[model samples]
Target: MSKRCFLIEASNQEATEGQIMTVVQSSASHPLYGDIVTIVGKNRVNDNPVIISAYSKDSCHLEAERPGIVVMPNSVEEVQKIVRLCSSTKTPIMPAGGRNGICGACLPRVTNAVMLDMINMNGIVNLDEDVMTITVEAGMRWAELIHRLDDKGYKLGFRGPYGGNAATVAGSVSINSMGYAASRFGPAPEGVVSLEVVLPNGEIVRTGSGWNPEAQIFTRYSSFADLTGIFLGDHGTLGVKTKVTFKIYPKAEFSTYIDLGYKNLKDATAAFLEIQKRGLTEELNCLLARESADTYFPGLLDSHPEINATIHCVIMETDKQLAERKVQIIRDIGLDLKGKDLGNFAAQIHWAEKFNEVQPMYNNGFWLNTCHLRPISRIPELMDRMRAIFKKYSLEKNGIKWIADALAVDRAYAAAWVTIFAPTKDKMELAEKAWNEMLDAAMETGGCPYWSGLLWEKRALEKVNDTFIQLYRTIKKSIDP
Candidate 1:
């Protein structure tokens, strides 16, 4: 921990860099600190992790809150010990997983906080063949997990975001993440069966069937209440997730793409709503707005200049006939809405090149995208507000673009996201302003942003009811105390 200076006003935000430097230097004296350091090893725990090291760089856009000390525990017991140590020291502990999240959720808002890098904690706990479930430590990345499961002839219904190579399983659960195969099985919350959490006070609580020794890991329902929901999408406010359990699925029998080109946003969004109502697609995503298609996909808009919004859908079924029929249903609706069938070849290519198709690699360079979750019906207004924000910030030339992705879950729709590539320092500032405005517009349109990371805390506060906030505060105090 370096003695870097952190300036502050009288109100809000705790700890100066100088204080963090002093505190962490003296943290070794805490009662259990020595044991934890000895177990986790000082090398992995004392300094910042490499993934978030560039967090201090303004141009990096990592939004990592300044960290005092980082701890990487390899086992559940080690995590418990570390949590207990932080609890006793009255230190705020923030957990970071893969450092791939855009919402700044892993960053510590409270100054001089402890960063619990969970990568070392990853381990395969169990694979119950009969129950079709697997128990894994929190830090397992989706790529590794998927490969492991595939080798065993099994797969998950829900999965990590496009950045699955670095996205953590527990992190996905906490954020209610959406990504590939989502149209078939919903998001992170749907597949999760249980979680083992270390509360802020260092107490380890197992949700779901783990509570019953006789039927452990078999079921999530209880005679009293199912407690796993409390930890899902919690953003680490209540506790640190140590382990996760979820059901596995047989690999999909068939999967293909369906492309629809709308002349304008209105018809395109209507087609989206129709497809959403049916909920048959394995994955549903669209590149709306000509600017977005041009800037991010470069040459894409040139090829489809007449298209206002291009939807690329993934159709899945056990048999080819069934899948083709589902495709017709969507095609009919899209045409009914005055949309043109752009053919599936283009969308199929994009689906095949899903992970590396280029949002982050535009003309200027790296890009940032912000998204909000709303109903299918409200997507039109949401997209309009996003356009307004880009116009207001004079950011259209900054390569600004937007999209909408339909959630695999029933009656669920996401107003996809707005993307802008700002390769330079000055342009990045403008893009960031556009991002904030995009969030505001989501709220104004009666929609909530995707993740409740630190970035959206203030906006959430403004819209969240006081009673719910009070209850949350009370719960945080009780478990975290």
Candidate 2:
């Protein structure tokens, strides 16, 4: 990959490197810098790949202003202490976990910021089967958690996103990711029972039912006011997640797959909504455009009859018969709409290798994805607008491909459109134009785009209720001030 840097701020020009390093040297001057916490100046911090990797080194592909100082803290106490030091110095803090997110929200927007590297704080705090919840430190990985739960005869309510193994629990919850298990259990935030949040001022507060003295981490929406929702998708703006508790479920007795092809995008989305309305599928993981199918699953794409779209369904139930019945319903719906049964053979094969399937859809390289979530009734409208944007920009011929997921028929399902292309100057410009138009249409039509904090928050909120932006700004200031 070509290495290019876009300095996000002028703080570097205003303050010299020596002046920046002074912040760290000054922090170690405090007596609170204990054995569990280590402070590194710009020289040492920039040299360490692990810390830098968490900043802008992974999949997000955006350049972050290099922090003047980096702090490594292994425990919550150390985390609080580090936060206080940054607070006292009035340095902006950006928190990170696993370093695998493609969304640029975690990157620092300004220079001289301090990064809260939470990797070392990973530890399973408790597993209360009696309460039917498990508590883990914020830095724990989803891949490990899944295996751990299964080892003890339990399962999570949701699957991590395709990159779940590389994404942290706190990270995914912060984004409220809609993943493979969304149709079955709900969004990532739905499974979160409580949060142990380190406030901007370094105070640790517990939310959920645990807010009271009972200490049982099972339920959300305690008798008191629920503050947990405030942080569910905040992207770590309000505070740092120290610990979290999530609801769990029994392992499904049966899991099955089915694939269907549609002649048009509109019909595929309609079929998906109907399937979702009937609650027949546990997961509608893939809604691939023709180009998407070609790029991601060439073999399957070759077998299909030049269909414009394809949908992948994952059905699960305790009884094998019931699972098969739901899949049949999906097939019937698809066929009724003049759809083709591509057969479950390809879907089954995809499921077998789904754990490591992130790269196939990534366009073999760089791409931008627009995640739009709205009710099923509006998907066709959104599709028309999205297609127009692509046509206007001639994105179809430029290697751009669109993909959507049936987030839920019962809720606002997501319709994600991705454009894959090499980073050539002309293609990059066109890609930008297409992305902006797609997102604008999404919010204009009562849909919310993904990565709200960074990409679509202002526009989406303004379209819904203009006052919300101000209210959120006020809340942000109130919490961080």
Candidate 3:
């Protein structure tokens, strides 16, 4: 197998071997330093077999400025100690919680700095079902938490697909992740009731009702002007999260999957918006794209090939006896537009397969998958512009192929996922250009990109409304400065 190279540019310049070793020894001698092993042996962060020639004796660049490191922090005191040292030395620190961040948020900056990995701190501290809160160490796996909660007949609202198994509760909140159930419960940040953050100055700050009166929201009851919100999505730039307490919800009473196929992306999004606008179900998860429908349901795949040009599937659940009635409403919406319903049996079976099937989608194929986020209401416009762009890319001989899907956030909000496949590298570039145009068009229609925090490029970010960016900047300066 050939190894692919990832392009990286460091905001901070790389340090020399002598300087790197000096920094390493400084931390190694610090009181908080538990295990200071050099980045030696074989590198496993990116899983690529390529040899890195420009690396220092212990460290190597994996992606962009992200240098991977493994650290063993034995205690909270140790974490605080390291933070103090990093702050005093002016070294950037990146935290790794379970090493499952797809966007390289945990990857170290290009400078000769320490990467604090919180894998060893996986402990469930307290489970207070009375108030419906679970307090666990920052490194605890979400799946373990879900398993424990399931034993008690409850679970967290957003467990994030299969990635939850390798994900940490603190990491999810830090990244502001909104998994499958994001529409109803909101993102991970909203679920967090309190946070335990180790500041760069070696001080531990505990936020929320843990420190002060519940009614008093004006006071800086926690630490440094109430910086929990700042630290949540800082991408580990500000500080390290040691412990977290968040809300949980009961499992659904009943769940059903309904499949709807459309002749094109426009019709598919129309059906999705219809269900979202009409409140067709309490909990909804939908997958749209004719390709997915064809792959998941081959029987209908051939009979309704044109119907799949835009494929749609919905997952809805309710406790009431009128469950079928609600599903019928969704079915009716689909049927009204000449859409075909593959019924719930296929949807149920797909959900059962879950992430086991999703992970493989990114591997073992000559195709590429990229997505864009937009406000739910503007999905139709986005689709129209995207199809034109796809057509433009398809003029080449490689024969560009693609599929689009949309997930409804609410009546007025939604995110669309577009998958593109092309045979030539130039065609892929053209396809990427289309994706960017789609992203720009989405922003013009009041749609915010779903995960734009760690991409490093600020082009799409600059398109977001200035007010939110100002708020983000203020928070970053306060907590991370």
Highest TM-score among the candidates is held by which one?
Answer: 1
Model 3, 366-441: lDDT tens digits are 2433334555556667656666766665633446555555555546455565555554565656656665565565
Instruction: Candidate 3: list runs displaced more than 4 Å.
Output: 1-62, 213-228, 278-288, 295-300, 309-325, 332-339, 364-372, 395-401, 421-446, 453-456, 464-474
Candidate order by decreasing TM-score: 1, 2, 3
Per-residue lDDT of candidate 1, residues 40-97 (tens digit):
6554455434423533322236565676666666666667777887887887888878
TM-score of each: 0.86, 0.84, 0.75
lDDT of 2: 0.69
> What C-alpha lDDT values do all the predictions have?
0.70, 0.69, 0.57
Q: Specify the poorest-scoring 10-residue window by lDDT in model 1.
A: 11-20
What lDDT is reached at residue 400 by model 3?
A: 59
Name the better of 1 and 2 by lDDT: 1
**Best-fitting candidate, scored by lDDT:** 1
- TM-score quality measure for candidate 3: 0.75
Q: What is the alpha-carbon lDDT for the whole of candidate 3?
A: 0.57
